[model samples]
Target: MQRTLQPGQRCEVWIAGVTGESELVFTSDELLLEAPNWTLDGSALILNGDGKLWNFDVAGRTLSQVPLAGIPDLNNDHVLAPDGKQIFLSANDGHIYRAPLGGGAAERVTAVDGSFHFLHGVSPDGGELAYVGIDAGDFSQPGRLLTIPAGGGHSTLVDVGAGHCDGPEYSPDGKWLYLNTESFTSLPGHAQLARLRVDGTGFERLLDSETVDWFPHLSPDGDLASYIRFPHGTEGHPADLLVDVVLVSTGDWAAPLHTWPLFGGQGTLNVNSWSPDSARFAFVAYPLANTDSSKDHVRD
Candidate 1:
C-alpha cells in the first residue's frame, strides 16, 4: 500500500481487538480528522480537524463539534485529563490551554513566548501535563520533553540534553514518563522508545530499532505499551503510510507481543486510546476500503 496522505481525503475509525478482529467504528468524508482519543466513558471518540474538535458517538454513529469559544488554531496534540472532565489543548500560538471536555472557552496553560508546545498526555492524578516543546525560530533543533502544572504554571524541562523527542506520556502509577527520542540532528535520524522517572531520573531506552518509532502509549494497567513504527529512513511521520501498531509487554520490552499492519500512520496512534479495561484501543485509519485486511498477530 502507498503511504502518502493528502488533505480532504477520506478516513475511518477502528476499534482494534487484542487477539480477535478489528471493527470499523466511524468514517469521515475527508482527511480532516487526526488522532482519536477515547472518551473516559468509552462512549465516544474525540478528534480534531482544521483547528476544530468533534466528538463521534460509537453507539449512535453521530458526530458533534466540540465548541471552542475563543480558540481556533487547535492541533492534534490535545488530550483529555485522567478525570475525563477537562481537556488540555495545544494551540498554534505556542501555548497549551485547558478547558472543559464538553466544550467551553479554553484558558492558556503555558506562558511561554515564541515557542511551540504540543501536549501528549495528562498525569493520572490530573495535576500535571506532559508535552514536547519546540523552539519556534529553529525547526532543526530537537524538541524537549517538558511538564507543567495542569492548572497553568511555569514549565520544567525533563529531557535536558536530548536532540529531539516526542510523545511524552505518563504511566498509570505516575512513577515513570515514556517518550521517543532521536539523538541526532541529521536527516533520517533513528528514533527509539524510552522512559524516565517522573522527577527526571533513571532515563533509559525501552525499544530501539532501525524503523523510526513514535508515540509509545502505555495501557491503563501499565502492563503493555503500543506505538506506531515508520519505515526505516522515513524523514518524518506522515499520514497514509504502511505503518505497524507494535504492542509490547511493558514488563518486557525486548520484543513486541503483536504487530498490527495497517494503511495509516501519524494520527493512527498518536494519543492514549486504550479502553478503560485495557482490552482494546481506538485508532484512525484512512480510506475505509484499505482497512479490511488490517489485522493483528505475533511477530515472527
Candidate 2:
C-alpha cells in the first residue's frame, strides 16, 4: 500500500553536520517525500515522492521531477550508482532497473523470478548490486540478502543470520557491506547495526545498543556513518513515530557523534544521503501537528 501523511502533518527535509545542528532544507505540507540519495557532486538530493522520482536542489530549495519512463511506482529503496551518472531503482512491481540520473527511460535490471527485489546498495565499482529479496512478494517474511550483476543475472545469497536484515550498503572501499539485522538476539524485531565482508565472511556487529538501528550509510570518505534509530521493541521501522538520525565514527558505531531527533521512521533514512565530501548528510522528517493523537507514540 502507498504511504500517506497523517492528518495535519508535513514533510521536512534536513541537512545535518557531523558535529553541529541540523538545518531544515525544505518542507511540504502535502507531498510525501521518502529516502534521499545525495548526488555525488553535492548539489542536490534525489528523492522519491508521489510514486515518481525527483531531484531536490540544495541551493534553490526546489524540486524537479525526474523523467523516468517505463517503470512502476518506486519504493524508498532506490540507490545511486557508484558512477554517479546512473541510479538503480527498486520499484513497487518487485523488480529493479537502471536509469540515467539525467533522466530517460529506465532499463529493467532484475529478471529473477520468485522474489521481490528491494535495492539498497551498489558496489563501489558499479559492477554489482546488493538488495533484499522477499520471497513471492510476501512482506511478512524476513528479507534475504542477495547480490547480482548490475546489468542483471543470477543472484548469489549472502546470509547474515535467521532474523530479518535491511539497508545492505557497501563501504567506500568496497571491502564491507554495512546493514542492520536482528541476527544478534532472540528478541523479536530487535534489529542492530552490523556488517559483513563482501566475500560473505567476517560478519560482525558494529554496535551493541538498546535502540533498534537500521540503515547504516557510510560517507564517501568512509570516516563517518549515519543511521536511523527506532525505540526499543519497535517491530520494523514504521512511519509517524519519533526516531533519531544518528551520525557516528566508522571506527566506533557504539559512540554517536551526533543525533537528530524527529517524528519519522520508514521513509526517513531508508537510503544513503551522505554528501560527497562527507561533511553533512540528508534525511527527512514527517511531523504531525500537536493535536494529532499519533504523536503519543513518541518514545519517552
Candidate 3:
C-alpha cells in the first residue's frame, strides 16, 4: 500500500504492524509538514513549520493554522501537551511557548535570561514539561534539565553543573528521566545515556559509547527505544547520522538490536517524537555540506 503526498501535503497516518497489514487513519490535508506531532488520544495532529503551528482533524480532514505573534524561529525541540490540545515549543532565546492546537495565540512559559532553551519531552501525565536550558555563558558547562507546569509557572532546575548534558526523554512510566551527557571539549555528540530521578537525584549511567547516542524515544509500552547513532570519525566534512534501535534492558552496549544506514551523508539526524504505537518514528536529516549556489555535490 502507498499514499501520494506532496512536499507539504497533509495526509493520513499509514500504520503497518510488525506482521499485520497497513492501515490509514484518514486525516485532513497537510497544514505544515515541517514538524508533525500526534496527539495523545490519536484524535488530532499538531504540526509546527515555517513559523506557524497547525492543527489537523484526523476524521474530518481539516487543517487550522495557529498564529504565534512576536516569536522568532523555533528551536528543534518541541513537545505536545498531554491532553493533545496544545503545542509546546522552545525558543533559542531561553523561553518556552504554549499554543493551542486548534488555532490561537501562543503564550510564554519560561522567561529566564541568558539561557538557551531546548525542548526535551513531555511527562507521561502531561502535567509537567521537561526541557534543557543552558546558561548564556562561556558554553563551558552542562545545561540544566528542568520541569515546569504545563499551565505556566516558575521552572524548577533538576540537574546542575553536569558539564555537558543534552537530549532528555522521560520513560514511558515517568519513573526515569533519561538524558545524554558528554565530556568532549568541542562536540556535544560525544555523550552517553544517564537516568536520573524525577526529583533530581540517584543518577545512574545506563550506557556509554564512544560515538554519540541522542534523541532517545521510549516505545509506547516501554519495551524499546529508538535513537540515532552517529559514528565517531569524519572523513571529509562531518559524520553521518546512522539510525539505531536498541532494547532498553540491554544497558550493556556490547551490541545493538538492529542498525540501519540513512541515505543522506555528512549530515546530522534530529529525532524528537515517536509514533503513538511505537512502530515508527520521525526525524530530520541536516546536511553539513559547504556549498554555494553553483557547486558540484559529491559524497566524500
Candidate 4:
C-alpha cells in the first residue's frame, strides 16, 4: 500500500488499560488532525488541523472548529494548560502563543526573532512551560530543551547538552522533565528517552534501544510514560511508518509494560495525549491506499 497524503487518514481516540486491552473510543474520516489532548473535564478532545484548532466531542462523535480568530499557521506542537483553561500554540513562523481553551484570540508567549519554539508540556503548577527551541534555518543542529515562565518571560536553556532534544514533558508531580534526545548529527546513534530535573540536574537515561523513541508523555497519575517509537535509522520523525506506542513504568523504565503496534508515525503522539485519568490516550493513524508496493509493509 502506498501511503498518500490523500484523505485516507483515520483519527482515532483509544483508551489503553493498565492491565487490559486497548479500546477505540472514536474514529473518523477526517485526516491530518494531530496531537489531541483531552479536556480536563473529559468532555471532549482538542486537536489541531489546517493551521487551526478543533474540538471533537467524544460522546456525540461530532467535530467543530475552535474559533482562533486571528491566529493562523498553527502546528502540532500546541498543548493545553495544566489547568485546562488555556491552549499554547506554536506557529510556523517560530513563535509561541496562548489562547483561551474555549476559543478566542491568541496572545504571543515568546518574543523571539526567527527562532522556532515547539510547545511540549506545561508545568503542573502552571508556572512554567517546557519546550524545544532551535534556529529556524538550522536542521542539522539539535534543539534545546527550554523552560520559560508560563506568563511569558526570558527562556532558559535546560542544559541537556548537545542533541536533537524534543518533547519536553513534565511529570505530574512537577519534579522531573522527560524528553527524547537523538545524536545531533549522526544516524548510527539511536535516539534515547531521558528525564532530568527542572533545575537542569539529575539527568538520567531511561530507555536506550534499537528503536528511535520520541515524545514521552507521563500519565496524569505519574505512574506511566507512553511514547511513540520509530524504526531504527529513521532520519527524522516522518509519517506513514510502522510505529509502536510503548508504555513504560515511570519507576522502572527497563522494559515496556505494553506495546501496541500501528501504521502511523510522526503525527502520532507528537504531544501529550493522556486522559485525565491517565488510562487512555489519543493518537492518529493513516490507512494507506492499497497498491502492489504497499502490501502491509513497514517503512524503514
Best by TM-score: 2
- Pick out the ten consecutive residues of candidate 2 with the lowest summed lDDT: 291-300
For model 1, how does the per-residue alpha-carbon lDDT over 44-159 read when each residue is reduced to its tens digit? 88888777888989899988899987775777788898888888888777788888899998888887666788899788899999988888736688788888899888888885
- Candidate ranking (lDDT, best to worst): 2, 1, 4, 3
Q: Which prediction has more favorable lDDT, 2 or 4?
A: 2
Error of 2 at 40 (Å): 1.2
Error in Å for residue 124 of model 3: 2.1
Each model's C-alpha lDDT? 0.79, 0.90, 0.56, 0.78
Per-residue alpha-carbon lDDT of model 4 for 194-239, expressed as tens digits?
A: 8899888998888767788888898899888888989888766888
Which regions of candidate 3 fall more than 4 Å away from where they truly are? Answer: 1-36, 41-47, 54-67, 137-141, 183-189, 233-254, 263-271, 286-300
Candidate 3 per-residue C-alpha lDDT over 48-98 given as tens digits, one digit per residue, 9 for 90 to 100: 544556555756866666666656656445777767677788754567888
Candidate 1, position 261, lDDT? 77
Model 3, position 82: C-alpha lDDT score: 64
TM-score for every candidate vs. truth?
0.90, 0.96, 0.70, 0.90
Clashes of 1: 2
How well does model 2 score by local distance difference test? 0.90
Answer with 2 or 4, whichever has the higher TM-score: 2
Better of 1 and 3 by TM-score: 1
Q: Which segments of candidate 1 are over 4 A away from where they belong?
A: 1-8, 184-187, 288-300
